[model samples]
Structure formats: structure tokens, C-alpha cells
Target: MNAIDQNAIQTLFTEARTHNVWLDRDVSEQTLRELYHLMHFGPTSMNCQPLRVLFLKSQEAKERLKPALLPGNQEKTMQAPVVAVLGYDTEFYEHLPRMFSHNKEAKSLFEGKPDFINATAFRNSSIQGGYFILAARALGLSAGPMSGFNNAAVDEAFFPDGKVKSNFLCNLGYGDASALFPRQDRFAFDEVCDVL
Candidate 1:
């Protein structure tokens, strides 16, 4: 397979910023669907595909989410066009027959273990969240992903069924570049990586 172009790489990675200021633009339902279609393709352990998103687009919906946010995250999140509550389902194994069809026993591995279920769901959903941001950028939207909220409040407010758990919150919209803080330094490769 051919590698993607440099500009595409920049769009998805190098130049992407965590936006805190948004333009007064709307994120369409079609675009939100496309975002999910893109990010769901990211790999998960045993093809569990545990991530479930709740996108708050209406003022009423955002208001319901307001109490969960930490003070610092409240303003920017409410101002953004969309706020996605990224979560994972503990009963994700129930779908294994469809998602990992080749393995008839796939569901058995996680069905009865609470700790294991939590670990797998959390780990894989976090990976999907990374893909979520990249997918948003690939589609010309700015992303601001943060975890400063009260998870219990969010889960109770949104996923009251008690099966899904919140992982993080991400705001999506056209961003105000002028409001961005100066780019921060990243650790050099040798400072953080090691050869086997």
C-alpha cells in the first residue's frame, strides 16, 4: 500500500492542535456519522470495538452535561459545536459473535470477569479515542479532548444504564486559531524512546 502524502500526515498529526476556542460553526449530523465510521475501524483487542459515543449538539443536551465538567473545561466545551462523551461498554463481549465471528469462544474470555472486563474496555476505548481525534482532523474539524470532568456525574447524567463508563470528553468544531496558546515543546525521540 502506498503511504499517505505529507500534507495528509500534517493534517492528521503534526499540525493538529487541541483547540480551546471554537468558531460559531455547526457540525452536521452527516459529518458526525462519518466521524464514527472512520474511527470505528481502528483495531481493538479481539475486535471488541467497545467505544460508544454520545454527541451533545443541542443547547439542552449541553446543559445536561454542564454539571459534570470541571470549571476550566466548562466555557470552551459549551461553546463548541459538539461535545462527544467517549465511553466503553462493559458488556462488549455480548457482541463478539458478530465482531469477531471467527471465534465462537471470544465472548467467554470476558463474560464473567469484572476486573478483566473493565481493563479491556478501558484500554481499547482509549485507543479508539485517539482514532476519534485523528478522524475529526482528517475531516477538517478541530478537536479538543480532555478528562477533567467528574466521571460519575457524566455517566449518571448520560449513560444511566450502568453498563457504559465514560472515558473522556472531546469538543469538536471549527477552531479559532488566533486564540491558540503558543505551541508547547515535545520530548525528543531519545528522551522518551528506547531500542530493544
Candidate 2:
């Protein structure tokens, strides 16, 4: 497969920043749908595809989410065009029969296994969250993914059914780049990776 150009790479990674401040802009419903369509194609373990997103776009919806956020995250998240409550369904294995059609027995592996179910759901959903950010960026939006929130509170407020668990919160919108701090440092490849 051909590699994407440098500009595309920059859009997805290099030039992308974790934006805490949003401009006075709105993310349309169509863009939100398109974002999910692009990210859903990202691969998951055994095609589990357990990531379930709840996009909080309205003032009322964001208000329901307010109490769950940490003080530092509250203002920015409230101001964002969309605050995505990224979660994973504990009952994801039930859908394996439909999602992993090639392997009819895939569902059996996770059924009645609480620890296994939780591990797979969390791991795969986290991977999908990464894809969500890239997809948002590719569509010319900025992302601020944060974990400073009360998980149990959020789950009760939004996913009260208990079938899904909140993984993290990401604020999405047209970023106020001027509000960003100077780019932070990262470990070099040699410091973080080893060639075997």
C-alpha cells in the first residue's frame, strides 16, 4: 500500500496538539457521523469492535456530564463543540457472532469470563479512541483527550444500564491554538524503543 503524504501525516500526528480551548464553533451532526465511520474501520482484537461513543453536544447533555468532570477539565469540556464519552460495552462478546462472522466460535471465548471480557473490551476500545482522534484531525478538527473524570459517576449519569463502562473523555472542536502551551517534549526513539 502507498504511504500517505507528509501533510497528511502532520495532520494526524506531528502538527496535532491536545487542545484545551475551543473556538466559538460547532461540529455538525454529519461531521460527527463521518468521524465515527472513519474510525470504526480501525482494527480490533478478534474484530471485537466494542468501542461505543456517546457524543454530548447539547447544553443539557453537557450539563449532565458536568458533575463527573474534574475541576480543571470542566470549563474546556463544557466549551467544546462536542464532548465524546468513549466507552466499552461489557456485553461486547454477545455481538461477536455478528461481527466476527468468519469465526463462529469467537463468542464462546469471552462468554461468562468477566476478567477476559473486561480486558479485551478496555484494550480494544482504547485503541479505537486513538483512531477517533486521528479521524477527527483528518477532518480538520482538534482533540483534547483527558482522563481527569469520575468514571463511576459518568457511568451512572450516562450509561446507567451498566452494560457499558466509560473509558475516557475527549473534547472536540475548532481549537483555539493561541491558548495552547508550548509543545511538550517526547522521548527519542532510542530512549523508548529497542531494535532487537
- Using all chains and alpha carbons, the TM-scores for the candidates as numbered come to 0.99, 0.99
Going through the candidates in order, what is the number of backbone clashes in each? 0, 0
Q: Estimate every model's Cα lDDT from 0 to 1.
A: 0.96, 0.96
As for model 1, its CA RMSD to the true structure in angstroms is: 0.6
Candidate 2 structure quality by residue, lDDT tens digits, 23-132 = 99989999999999999999999899999999999999999999999999999998999999999999999998899999999999987899999999999999999999
Q: Quote model 2's TM-score.
A: 0.99
lDDT of 2 at 88: 98
Clashes in predicted model 1: 0
Task: For candidate 1, give the lDDT.
Answer: 0.96
Candidate 1 per-residue lDDT, tens place, 95-142, comes to 999999999999998878999999999999999999999999999999
Which stretches in model 2 have alpha-carbon errors above 4 Å? none
Give residue 84's error in model 1 in angstroms.
0.3
